[model samples]
Target: MNFLPTDDQLAFRDTAVRFAREKLAGTYLQRARIHTLDRQLVREMGALGLIGPDLPEEFGGMGLDYTTAGLMTEAIAYGDFNISYIQLLASLMGGMVAQHAGRDISMEWIPRVIAGEKIIGLGLTEPRGGSDAAGLQLKAEKTANGWRLNGEKTSMSAADQADAAVIFARTEDSTTGSNGVSAFFVDLTEKGISRTHFDDIGTKPVGRGSVFFDDVVIPSECLMATEGRAFGTIMAGFDFSRALIGLECIAPAQASVDETWAYIQEREAFGAPLAQYQGVTFPLAEAETQLTMMRQLCYYTLNLRDSGNSHTAEAAMCKWYVPKTTCEIIHQCLILHGHYGYTTDLPFHQRYNDVLGLQIGDGTAQIQKLVIAREKVGRVALQYDKQAKGGAA
Candidate 1:
């Protein structure tokens, strides 16, 4: 029932906070203006062990827990809303590489990924749809040499910039549903691969776009986990990333609120500071309360993960609750800024744009709620399923 962060968590948080303020805060907007990120900054993050601190020591990580990982992500988000995705990707893909990829592949790539020398993107969502992740349409056929991939993955983060990707394709018939999908660690630069970048509204640094694989040959050893069983195994770690995504959105929203509070306290209206008025102050108070609640839930979900407990419902709660609340809170902060927030002159607008994307990505609010419902109701949640029709009364 301890609420305080341990000494190691505090040290990591302090370092991440300092790194964000010093390196990311000042340049975040300027970089976003051009929809580009300095690759060197990622390397700097790797140098500081900020990329994947929760990864094992053998993989060039600090071997911390998921809760500590969330703290680093939250602190980094305070300075740069979009760059925290780098940390998120590091944790997600790096964990997969360490645990699922072959030994030679892990030895060659894991350390480099930890050092920020390479970037790995998740290629699960296709151009057809994203919500039904297991029902992917990408085709992977067995070849004499290995697997031949022929499909396009759209809305992928780091699509054009990623050195590699953990791609999922259907090795079996679509009738197999989730069980038909197989994961592959493919080199993005391999022959027959083509990519195009998207003009996304936010999180510009990690460009989202489509990656087309046209009969690309992948070695057999590149297969991750058991073929056709990879979807559930690889996706087991998604709960961890969902919680981190929650913190990423919350951190920026919290920052905007803090900045707005300072503004209202100093700015005057009708010969009195804005903070003196209940209309202005009360909403801020409400926002603070909600932020505190969401923050506690996020870390608690991570703690559940670190303790090896079932947190599917809690992670879904964090993913849905945090971003939805963040959008509302940041919108208020924007309004509180009184037209200054409307302009690009301040970071509030940018944060708003950045957070809106989260509400859609990493499973939407509706999808998360469905997950929560499924977890809570158990078999009752599946009573209306098409497959359950035969057994239902």
Candidate 2:
């Protein structure tokens, strides 16, 4: 399949790149250290139609394809990796809402999200686990007017800062795993909702935290998809996000590599420029090759999604491989810069730390590999574990 950007896609990418380079790159380091993102900056991105340009024209988006969305993600990420989280969340969470939530809900929130007037965070991962997404413990009991939620979601980006969230809860008392799970659109300002932030090593601006829902209530219209089957339907959006995430991680590593390449030309070692050394140049060359491949893979996955094709395996591959490899590439770039890379004055350390989070967030390498295997061989790959545990295979 062709991965070349069309004129319109290229135009969007150029605009995103210009905004990133001009506005985001200059303050990336300063912004990275902060716990909360600057809302004004987020609004500026919204004003530029850079947040969720792929949602739909009716929802305040430009009706762009997922591939164009990936392009925008990559371009913005090149300037500020953390800031790109906004674009990622908007597309992932906003798309879910647009496709699943009631029209009124989508009409009200999607525009705000697109306008950067509000933020909607995902509430899938619980305090128990993130990778085992279906094993939810949050409770959502039907009330007279709506549902009452009582549970805690952990490791969510923008937990404390989100205006609202798409929360998942188990509605069936006798069921376990994904069966009883239901999704909800809950306002974070509702009563009994509390949040706590973590002192993460990176992506601090995204503010990974726990959102505790204590007897929180939401209207019946908040329920998304089938009551007991929302888990599977809502999760399909992740395949899209996974590919976008690949681009997100790749951008910073790419930026680091680009900087190191320029650096080697000026820095002298052994009375010669570092660029003249095969030892220094070879790793950068290898990095470029890998980056090119990973970028294509990510865009290919996005294209698969745009084409209405099954991409679970490819998305899993992108999710697992790209983040891990990009982290390594960033680390190597950091080392190639010597001690300066370790210092805060340079962006290498920050880029490493920022990209490092993706290796753990979304899903871990081991988990993604399992997903890939499951996709290739179906449930057969997991039958052995079920048999060992005395369950029906």
Candidate 3:
């Protein structure tokens, strides 16, 4: 119940904050516009043990708790939202690989991911839909030596740049939905794989794109968890990522608020500083209040995960609410800055666009609400029962 950070947690958070302020803040805008993240900077982060410190030290991490990872993600995002994507993926996708993938695979690739020498992306959403994640279309047929994968995964973050990916494919031809899906760790540089990047409005450095697999073959050892039953097990890791994502979205919005506070104090309006006007100051004050509440909720959710408690409902709440609310806060901060915020010279527009993506990416607000309802009332609250009843009629 106690959310207070121990001394060790505070040390990790302080290190991340110092790194972000000194190394990431100054060139965040410059880096944000780029097509790919700075590999050198990522390696720098890796060297400092900032990537996935929660993973076991045997796998090249510091063996910290999930809350520490969340704090690092939030601190990094405050300086550069795009760079924090690396932290998110490392902890989310990399953890999946470590826990589910074969020990050999985890040892070989995870260390690289933790070291920032490689990136691991998730392959779940297809061209058809993301929310119906279980209804994947990618095919993975068993082969003599391994599995042959043939399909396209779209909307993958860092799709083109990721060194490897944990892909979910439909393994049984006759079965559908979550029943027949299997997960695999595939090297992106495999012979039959091709990649493309999207022209997104924000998070350009963390590019979103499509990864096309054409009869790509991976060894059987790459298969993660129980074959044809990996969907539910592998996906449980998202509860951790959802909470981290809340922190990720909050940081940039907070940065914008901080900048606006300083701006209003200096800019004069009606022969007085803008800060003198209650109209200007009130919005920022309200934003601070919202940010504090959202932050506490996010950390509390992370704590639940760390404590081995059920957090599906809380994680969904963090996933759905924080991103949408923070985007609003950032937009308000942009308006408070007047026309100056609209210009590219300032970070408000970029922060707004970046934070806005999260509202749609992880899971939409509507989907999260459905998850919450299902958690509260079981299957009776889901659409499957209605569909079944209509079919029976």
Best candidate (score: TM-score)? 2
lDDT of 1 at 47: 92
Runs off by more than 4 Å, candidate 1: 387-393
Predicted candidate 3 versus true structure: per-residue lDDT over 1-393, tens digit per residue = 988889999888898899999999889999989999999999999998899989888888888899999999999999999999999999998899989988998899989988999999999999997888898999999999999999999999999999999999999999977999999999999999999999999999998999999999889998999999999999999899999999999999899899899999999988999999999999999999999999999999999989999999999999999999999999998888778788999988888888888888978999889889989988764567668778421
Q: lDDT for model 2, on a 0 to 1 scale?
A: 0.93
Please give the lDDT score at residue 32 for candidate 3. Answer: 86
Candidate with best lDDT: 2
lDDT per residue as tens, model 2, 1-393: 999999999999999999999999988999999999999999999999999989989988888999999999999999999999999999999999999999999999999999988999999998776789889998999999999999899999999999999999999999988899999998899999999999999999998999998999889999999999999999989999999999999999999899999999999988999999999999999999999999999999989999999999999999999989999999998899889888999998888889888889999999999999999888885899899999978
Task: Go through the candidates in order and give the clash count of each.
Answer: 0, 0, 0
Give the lowest summed-lDDT range of ten residues in model 2: 126-135
Residues 124-162 of candidate 1: C-alpha lDDT, one tens digit per residue: 988667788777889899988789999999889888899
Local distance difference test, each candidate: 0.88, 0.93, 0.92
Position 385, candidate 2: lDDT: 89
| Candidate 3: C-alpha lDDT | 0.92
Error of 3 at 304 (Å): 0.8
